[model samples]
Target: MSGSGSQGNGQRLRADCERCAGLCCVALPFTASADFAADKPAGQRCTHLTAENRCSIHAGLRASGFTGCAVFDCYGAGQRVTARPELTPGPEMFAVFRVTRPLHELLWLLTEAEATGHGGAARPLIAEIEALVDGDAAELRGVDVTAWRARVGPVLEEVSERVRRGLGGRDLRHADLVGARLRDGQLRGTTLRGALLIAADLRGADLHRADLLGADLRDADLRGADLADALFLTQPQLNAAHGDGTTTVPGALTRPVHWPSGSSPARHEAPHRARGMPPGKAAPVGGGSGLGGRSGNGRRTGRGGRGRRNDRAGGADGTEGPGRRPG
Candidate 1:
């Protein structure tokens, strides 16, 4: 139910590694799990990171056991932090990144809420957050993100309620439904915020208008599920889950490259145009230029790469999931 005018706003929130200083590669830590090939401690650079701040294995992240890198979306915070030369590659910069990452994510969520036509109540908060994002490193680091979330949470919930007013969906916020069998279920307008749906069977489910803010979807089966209008659903969440050509994601997000190819031609074409890029021109996986004519991490090598995906932090349990790093 998002208006077309604001639908394109989400593009600005995506990660643009070209303008970044490889913050995620160095600022965050990852265990040697299914998503990462090796253990990388916080503040230490990944071995794959190159002199130019690009991932050396850009072309083969998933194949190289760096699937976590492939799907991480910084929501544009990496570039924002990199814009300040004084904060480059330092503890202050990383700390600022930790705070700004969630703020940018809040911006994305509020933008989506506005698109829903019920976000009139969210505009003021959006502007306030935007101003905070534009602040200097000192101001940014001092921000109380927990307090901001406390303020923004209810506004988003109100938007969700208004959007799903008549659907009478279930209230399952913060529920532990890990691996539950809910395939082909009627989940329309459900409030699934912060739900742990890791590896749950949601195949062929109807999730239209469901509130998906902060939901952990690692390994969740979304094949053929309808998320065309899911509330607050993000690219990182989509990247973490298993979907196919039959899966219907929101209009703003692209079908993850790793998803089975050649299934949803119509769905595939819209995201490119939506992101203002021509077909097959999105920023290559794991950004930066090298082998296979692709870029490092999830960035495009040179200036021509347009529309990079964003990233998210880990779930509430403080564990790394697909497309998510530890918070």
Candidate 2:
């Protein structure tokens, strides 16, 4: 409805956050609720926001019942353009995100449509938006909505380099990576709200009680990942990842997925080498010695006692258990 297609000279494209100032926060309307306390109208200023356009109540948003504000992601608008490269001076940065706020909302809807399997209309629209962004990179520093729209297009085509940079990493929010190989990685209780995973390989990872709100599971591999008491991890995330008959996920989460067809669900066990060794040595070279051959341990302990050590370790030799840590 608010301009939705590509035009000539790329004038039909939408605004690009990377090339604009931060807008969504200052322009949008919000009602008082459990998440927000102030009742502000559209295009009005937020009480917590300062004259420099910074949120004065940023630190106390959550404590003051503004949880929703805490989780909102502006599709990398702030970091990509305004905060990045220290784009313009402080005063100029204020207007950047705000000017493009309305356009950002529109673009967000299109992106949602694209993600939900409606790419046909969204694709070209996004392309047009990209072109406009290129033209407005430096011009939008001042306020000229018509000129900006005239130069840009109604829709966006392709992604701006700035926006793309924002989504470079995985959006683990509401994701499920059970038994997934995230060893020694920095997944500190990530917000895996409601993801579906089956037998992932998460070994020796530092998942200090991640939030697993409502994930699905079938057969995941959470070998050594420490989700000790992660928040929100419900039964769904556990069950979808093969959390079974005796499997123990986070203390607060429940197992949703049934075990494999014929086999009984196994219990959550520590890494083999981790049995008697310290937590540091949990991920041994032949970590899951049972899955791969003992030869894999060559790098860890060397070929010192090869044969004798193999038998003494009571190696299963061919059974693929949960200890196989993916790189």
Candidate 3:
């Protein structure tokens, strides 16, 4: 699945909500589910929303049994709207419009979240919303938003078309895809917890502060991508995506496995920090219990070998090491 991002040329294509009254949320509908505390119809007010156009339950939503509100993330849509210079509207209108605007954005995000048969159409529609939100409403008041939305609806239909083709598949858990080439692709803050992808291609794609716990990578390539201050993307994702030999992965992450040009046999899984050594440790010299060491046709080398020897070299069965059998 992919999502659009707030970076690249597309970054300039986002909506400026400050100019307009909240439109999307007021225009949308929702059921009274655990995520939402009340059932609201399209064009209705949310009870928890304040008159000043802010969430009244902002701080206490989770404790108030609105866990859904906690998980909701708008891809900087609110900031973009507020940043517009000429698009200022009154609080009265904002109070009524805030709900719809967020709802519209939510629908748009959902449309792009999955690889549906309508991805192509949905993408441009989302783009249209971005464009509309970016422009001065006074300038666009003459331009029929309803007609534009109607025109863009079919584009959403086409979103499914592109999605069916299976063009992009990338999991960026705490991945460092800064400046990556993710043009017109999807990856809107997809769960990238503890992934490593230094400088990957992600232009015109989505990535709104995705979770990026202890990911590992160094100086890769990230042109035309959207990182936008992703969360938990420690120095490793940065270094790996765009690092040199001097680059170092974060302590939480293990060193990446460097693969040469040609294909090689699959190695063992690297160990986590708890198993006496960190991840990516080499196999024992001869072969013993090792998560990622080589076997049969391969030999441990350099630091990997050293870590392996230090960890598994000790034994009590009278053998020289954990892997080396007694003759």
Candidate lDDT values, in order: 0.64, 0.35, 0.33
Model 3 TM-score, 2 decimals: 0.30
For candidate 1, write residues 76-190 as lDDT tens digits. 7788888876766888887787677767767777787787778897799989988987777798888877567667777887888899989989998757666778889999999
Best-fitting candidate, measured by TM-score?
Answer: 1
lDDT of candidate 2 vs native?
0.35
TM-score of each: 0.77, 0.29, 0.30
After superposition, candidate 3 runs with Cα above 4 Å error = 1-60, 71-73, 86-131, 139-146, 165-327
Q: In angstroms, give how far residue 194 of model 3 lies from its true place.
A: 31
- Return the number of clashes found in candidate 2: 59
Query: Model 3, range 279-304, lDDT digits (tens) per residue?
Result: 23221111111111112001222012
* Model 2: per-residue Cα lDDT at residue 269: 33
Better of 1 and 3 by TM-score: 1
Clashes of each: 16, 59, 86
Best by lDDT: 1
